[model samples]
Target: MKLPESQVAALNAASATDETPIDRLAEEAGLKPETATQAVFELRDEGLLEVTERESVEYELTDEGAEYVESGLPEVRLYRTAVEAGTDDAPAQMGRIIGASGLEGPEIDIALANFGRKGYGDIDSGELSADPDADADDDPEAAALAALAEGGAVDDVDADVLDQLVSRNLLDRHERVVRTITLTDAGVTALMEGIETAETVDRLTPEMLTSGEWQDVEFTEYNVEADAPEVRGGKTHVLRQTAERVKDVLVGMGFQEMEGPHADADFWINDCLFMPQDHPARTHWDRFALDVPPIEHLPEDLVDRVESAHREGVGEDGDGYHSPWSEDFARAVALRGHTTSLSMRYLSGTEVGELEPPQRYFSVEKVYRNDTLDATHLLEFFQIEGWVMAENLSVRDLMGTFVEFYEQFGITDIQFKPHYNPYTEPSFELFGKHPTTGELIEIGNSGMFRDEVLEPLGVEHDVMAWGLALERLAMLTTGAEDIRDLHGTLADLDFLRGAEVTY
Candidate 1:
C-alpha cells in the first residue's frame, strides 16, 4: 500500500505496545501537529493505526500574570517595598509603601489584601510591615504562575496554587482534548507487508498528465467526505439575507417597498401614529433622542393637521389630547423605535406620492430602541413593517396577511392575542410556535390603523398594518435560541457558516 509522506511517517512512529500522544509522534516524525492529525485519521480509516482521545484542562497566564512575571507579582512587589522601607519593629505607612510599590488603582487594593493573605506582610493602623519570616521566593502561587507564564498544562502545577492564580484572575483555564495514536494489529501487519510513501502526488500537473511517464506516477487518493479548508467568499450577512428574503416575499405578494431614514421626526414616528407627545414611549427611557440637528422642514400644512390631531383630535368625533402639544416636541429628532414610522411616512404621502386605495407598501429596515438586551431583545434590530390601504380592510385581512407572510418561511402555526397600540385599533400580538422549544413566541403586532392615525395622513381608506421583529423571524428560521446570536457580536460563526438558508 502507498500513502503520503506524512501518513507513512506517522504510521512508522506509532507505538505497537504502548500508547503515544500524537504530539510526540509528530515531533519524532518532523511533522506539524495538524499535518500529523490528518495523517493519523487517514491511517485510522485504512486500518493502519488506532487513535484515542482524552480531554484535560490546560492553563495559561493572563495579561496581568505575564506582566507580573516580568515585574513581580503585586503582593511580591508590596512585600519587597515594605522590607526595604521598614524593620520588623518599625513599619512604614501603608500608603507610603503602596505609592512606592508603583501599584495604582485596583492594583493597590489587590497588593494590600493579598500581601497579608499570603503571610508576606501585615497591615494595621495604616502601617505596613513584612512578616520577616515569609520569603517571597517561597511563594507557591507566584512560582506556579511564573512557570505557567510561559504556558503549560494545568496538571503540571500545584492545584492549590492554580486555584489561587485563577481566583486572582491571573490565569485562564480551558478544556483541551489530547489524541494518542497507536499501532493496531492490522497496522503491524501492514508495516510488515511493506508500505511505500514516495513521489505521491496530490494533484496532477498538465506536464505530468500529458507525459508518458505519468503512467509510472502514483496519484493521491481523494477522500470526498474529508473537510476542505474554509473558503469565505463575499455573502450578505445572515440578518440581511433574512431581510432580503422578506422583501422578495412581500414584493412577490404585490407590495411596493418603502425607504426612509433610520432617524426621523417624532411627528411621523409618534404624532402621526396617534402616539401622544407625553406618552411614556416618547421618553428617554424608551427612545434614543438625537442631540444634533433637530428635525425641520416639515410640511407646514401637515404639521398643523397633526398638531390639531394631538391637541384636539382629528375630523368628526376626533377629540384630540387637549394636552400641551408643541410642534417643537413633534419635531424632536430621534432614532425610530419601529419601521412603522416608514409606514406612516408612506401613508401620509410624505415619502412617495399621494396614497391611492388598494396600494400595498412594506419596509424591512433597522430600528433603534432604548431596551435592556437579553436572549430575545436587542437595542437595534430590523422590523418588518407593512401596510395595505384599501376600502374597508378588516382584521381577517390583517391576520391573513400575517399568515401568508410567515408561511413563506415555513412557519405555519400562528396565533393572535388581542393587544393594544395607540395607532392601531383592535390590535393583535402575533405569535408563532418555536420550532425547537415548541413554545409560542411573540412574533409581532398588527391591526387596522385607527381613524385618528389615517385621517391626519389624508388616508381615508381602511388600512391594515404590522410591525414584526426581523430578528425574531430570523431566530425562528435559523433555530437560534438567543436573539444576540442571530446577528450581534455574540453571534456563533459556526452556526452562521453551516446554517441552511431556507427560502
Candidate 2:
C-alpha cells in the first residue's frame, strides 16, 4: 500500500475503535492542523477513514464580566447596598442607595437597569426598595459568571441565564464545527499491510532543478475538493470601499470635491450657517470643543457680513433671531460637527476663490459628535455633505437630486418628512426602508439654503444643501441591521468581508 507522507502519518495516528478529534490526531501526527485536515479528507475520499463533524460551543467572559466576578455584579451590589441602608423595610432615596453602592459612571446605569429586572428591588419616583425575599447570593447570572471564571462545567449553568449574560455583553458565545477522524476497515487493512510513504513534491525546488531530478520526481496529486483554511488577505474595508464609490458617483455627477480642516472655528461650522450662538447644539455637551487658542485667521469681511445677518436680517422680509451674537464664540475652535463648514468656506471665497452659479460641490468627510453609542449611532462617522449652487433652485430640484443619487445605490423607495434646520428653508429628513429590518431609518437632511444662510456668505444664487449619513446609507445598501456591525469595536469581520456593495 502507498500513500503521501501526510496521509500515512494521519492514518497511523487515527484509531479504528475510538473517534479522535482532529486536533489530537494532528498533534500525534506532528502535522499542521490544516495539513492534517486535508490529508484526512483525502483518506476519506479513498474510503480509508471516516470523518464526522459536530458543533462545539464555547463561552468566555467579557472584560465587564471579569470585573464583576472580581467585584460583584452591579445589580447585586446595588441590592446589597439598598438592603444595608434599610431599604428592604421601606423605600429610600435612590441617590443615597446608589451613592453607597460605590458604582459610578456607566456602572450606575447598569445597576439601575438590571436591578429592577432581576427582582432585586423596585425603583419609583427617585426612590429604591430592596426585596427582602430576593436572594442576590443565588443570582443565576452572577453564579454563571463566577462558574465560568472558576473553570466550572458549562453544562451546570442555565442556558437562559447564559443567553441573558450574552445580551448584556457580559459574555461572548462562540460556535465552531469540530471534526473527528476515525479509521475505517480499509484503513485498518492498509495499516496491517504496512503502507509505504510516497515521495511526492508539492513544489519544485532549485536543488531538484539544478540536479536535473525534477522531471523524475513524483508531484503530489492536487485535491481541489479539499477544504482549505480561509485566507483573508489585505483588502479595503467595506466602509472605505463605499466611501470611494460615493466619491466616484459624486464626481461623475459633475460635482467637484471639497476639502478643509477637520478642527476649525465655529464661525464656518455654525455661525455662518445662521445657527444661533446660544442654540442648544452649540453647547459643549453636543460638540467636541478643543482647548486650543481661538482661530486667528478668519475672513474679516465675511465675518462682518455674517454678524450683520445674525444681528439684523438677511433681506427686507427676513428676520434674525433676537439672540445675542458674539465674535469670540464664533472664533472658538471645535471639531466640525458637519462638513457644511467646507461649503461655508467655499461660498465665502475663502477656499478656491469665489465660485459662480451652476456650481456643484461635495465632500465625504468624518465628523465628530458627543453621541451615545448604539446600534444606529456612533461618536464619529462619515457625512456625505454636498450642495448645488444654481438659479432658482426649488424643493423639486432637491427631491430630484436625491432620487438620482440614491438610485445609483439601488435605493428607490426613499421617503421624506418635513423637518426644521437652522440653515435651510423647507428642510426635509430623508428616510429609506432598511433592507433587513424593514424599518424606515433616517438617512439624511436636505433643503434649500435660506437667505439668512446664503447672504452671510455673499452668495446671490439659490443653493440646495444636504448632510447625509454615510453609515446609514451603507446600512441600507449592505442590509446591515446595526450600524455598529458596519464599523466599531463590535464590527463583524465576517459580515464586512462578505458584504457586497452592489452599484
Candidate 3:
C-alpha cells in the first residue's frame, strides 16, 4: 500500500500473455516491471506455483502462479516438477498437452499398446505415432527455442526468437538476456482456457454527471477501463498541495505571507543573525555560494553595528565577541540553507517598526543544502519558514504556533522538547507521532532570536523564527515512508491531485 498511485498505474504486465517473462510482465498487470517480477516470486513462495522448467534457464509455473499473482499475494510460490511421466498411479493426462501429444499417463500407454500390438512402426504415449527424432543439439539454442515455442512460453519469454536472432551473427553472452517471466494474476487468467471477458456493455454513468449537477467534473472520458481497482488516487501535487494546505493553516491564523529571492548574501542570511565568520555552516562547503562580483554591502547602520560588534562585543558581552567582521563573507552569495535566512532578511528589510500587538508571516519555498542525498535527505527541498513578531512573543508563543500548525493537519500528540539552533535561543525541535507509524518524527525547529543576533539589525522587538522542513511535514501528513516521494519524478498526476487536507 505504500506504493504510490503512479507505481500502481505503471504495473501493466498483469494483462500480458502467460508466457511473458517476469521482467516484462509489468504493463499487463498495470504495475511496475519490478513489482510484477516480485509478484511472481511471491506467488511461487506461497505454495501456489506449478512451475514447469521447460528450458534450462526459464521455468514456467502453471495457472496457480498466475492466480496467486493477480490476488496481490504473488510472493507465494508452490513449485512442482516441470513434467511427469505416465504410471499406474498417475492420471490419464499427466503432463500431456492433449490426449497423447502433450499428455503422459496410462491412457497414452493404452493407446500406444493397442497400436504397437498391431505391429505398429511406432507408438508414443497411448497413440499410434510416428516418432520424429530431432537432433535439437544441431542448434542447441534454436532447438530450445523451437521446443520452448511449441511448448508455449517457457515461464516468461513470450517474445519472438527473431528479435534475439537479429541482435548478431556472433552470439555474445553479454548481449544475451537471461531472465524468467512469470504470469501475473491477470496474465494467468487470460491464458486459461474458457477465460472470456464480460460482454461489452455501455459504461454505467452516474446520474450526477448527466444531470449537470457537478460542473467541476473534469474527468476524461474512458472508452474502456478495467474494473481492477488501482491504489486509489487523485490529488494536488503532493508537496505543492500539502504546501498550500499548510499555508492556509498558517495564513488563517493571521500569518502574513512572505517571499524572498532564492539567492541571498550572508549579511541577510547568517551574518546579520550573528553567525560567526569561522562557523562551519558559513563555509563554502556548507553553503552554495556565488562568485560573481563577490562582496555586497550590508545596511550602513547594520554594517557599522556588526563591524563594531566584531571590534568589541556589541551586545551582552561586548568583550569576547569583539572580533574582525568579514565584508567578504557578507558579500558572498549563496543559496539559502534555511528559510530562517529569509526570516532574517524579512526582519532586516523595511519594517512595521514593531509587532503592533501581534504580526505573523510565513513562506513555503525551496532551500538548498550541500549534503549527501538519501531516503531521508535531499540536496534541495522546500521549507515552510515563518515567524511571528509579537510584543509578548515568548517561548510559549512559539509553542502555540506549533500547536496551531499541527492541529490543522489533525495532529494532536506533539512533543515539544527543548533543542538548540544557532540563531535562536531557547530553541526547540517539534516532533509529532506519525499517524500511521507511531514513530516520533521531528517536524520543525523554532526559537527566539538572540539579542546578539537582533540588536545589530535595529528596532527589533521579540521575533520568533521557525524554519520547517516541508518534506518532514509531508512525511507527517501523508504518512510517506520516503522523503523523496515529495520530489519523485515518476509520480503520477493523481499522486497529489485531490488529497484530503485541511486549513
> Each prediction's Cα RMSD?
11.7, 5.5, 24.9
The estimated TM-scores of all candidates read 0.69, 0.78, 0.54
Candidate 1 per-residue lDDT over residues 1-503, each given as its tens digit? 87789888998899899898988999999998877777888888988888888988878788888888888888888888888886455887666787888988667656765776688866654567788888888788877877776564456667878766765667776656778888999999988999887777767779976786678887766655543454667667788888889999999999998899888988878888888888888886678899877787888888888787887886678788867788888888999999888888887787877977889988888898766455677668888888899997799888888889888999888898999898888899988877788777888998888888887788778999898998888878988887856665346555676675475
Better of 1 and 2 by TM-score: 2
Ranking according to TM-score, highest score first: 2, 1, 3
How much lDDT does candidate 1 score? 0.81
Worst 10 residues of 2 by lDDT: 370-379
Residue 32 CA error for candidate 1 (Å)?
Answer: 6.9
Put down candidate 3 lDDT per residue, 120-173, tens digits, no spaces: 223223222221232212423343344433555533433443223222111111
Residue-wise C-alpha lDDT for candidate 2, range 82-190, written one tens digit per residue = 9999999999977788899999987876677678778887876557899999999999999999999998878988788987787677889887788999999999999
- Which model scores highest in lDDT? 2
Candidate 3 residue runs with Cα over 4 Å from true position: 1-235, 295-297, 320-324, 351-357, 489-503
Q: After aligning candidate 3 to the native by TM-score, how far in Å is the CA of 131 from where it should be?
A: 58
